[model samples]
Target: MIRIKRIYEQLGDDDGYRILIDRLWPRGVSKENAHVDLWLKEIAPSTELRKWFGHDPEKWKEFGERYRKELSEEEEKEDLRRIKDLEKEHENVTLLYAGKDEVHTHALVLLEMINKKSS
Candidate 1:
């Protein structure tokens, strides 16, 4: 199963094979405290797309579309495949993100894609 959680949240026992998916390290979170099994910054949205979205609810739909397009490009295929591989290796793969807006974050879009592909 795939799960998404804010990196700032307390680590959970079931957060198996945690992967940090943010382009930048989360503010104030040290490497030791992150409990991340892998850091896939390459799978994150491009800096240009991130800055353009700016966590605005109004831009959420377009942001998801743009980010999905970015993830579909040739350069990102390897990282996308890695995520799928990890899901098969681990029972519960938790994707960590630093965004404050839980509902509108890129993790949600990524999760949708991963699950859709698996189905």
Candidate 2:
């Protein structure tokens, strides 16, 4: 199973194989506290796309499309494979992100992509 979670939330046992999916390290979060099993920065939306979206809800749809396009590249394909491998190895795989708006973040889009591919 795939799940989305905010990195700032308290770590829980059910959040198996936590993977940090943001391109940049979240400010003020210590590496030791993150409890992340993997840091797949390569799968994150490109810096340019991230800047363009600017976490604006109005741009969410476009951002998801643009980010999904980015994820279609060869390198991102490998990253998705890695995520799939983790999902197979663990009962639950949580894609962790730092954004405050969980519903509109790239993690949500990525989760949808993963589910689509798995199905």
Candidate 3:
């Protein structure tokens, strides 16, 4: 199963195979404290798209669609495949993001894509 979590949350043993999905490192977090097994920066939304979204609730739907398109690009295919591979290997794969608005974050969009692909 794949789960989305905030990078600032406390680490737990159940959060198997934590993957940091943000293009940039969180402002206050350190590598040691992150407890991330992998950092898939490439899977994140493009800088332009991120800037456009700005975590605005009004743009959430459009942001997800745009980000999904980004994920489907040729260069990003490998990253998606890698995530699928990790899903098969781990019982619980947690996707960690730094965004304060969890509902509007790229991680949620990515999680939906991953789930759709897996199903």
Runs of candidate 2 with Cα error greater than 4 angstroms are: none
Whose lDDT is higher: candidate 1's or candidate 2's? Answer: 1
Best by lDDT: 1
Q: Write the per-residue lDDT of candidate 2 for residues 1-118, one digit (tens) a residue.
A: 8899999999988999999999999988999999988898989998899999999999988898999899889888888888899989998999999999867889988988888778
Worst 10 residues of 1 by lDDT: 73-82
lDDT of each: 0.91, 0.90, 0.89
Instruction: Give per-model TM-scores.
Output: 0.95, 0.96, 0.95
TM-score result, candidate 1 = 0.95
lDDT (Cα) of model 3 = 0.89
Top of the candidates by TM-score: 2
Ranking by lDDT: 1, 2, 3
Question: What root-mean-square deviation over C-alphas does model 3 reach?
Answer: 0.9
Clashing residue pairs in candidate 1, if any?
A: none
Evaluated at residue 9, the lDDT of candidate 2 is 94
| lDDT (10s digit) by residue, model 3, range 1-119 | 78999999999889999999999999899898899999999899999999998889999989989999998898787787788899789988899999898678899889888877777
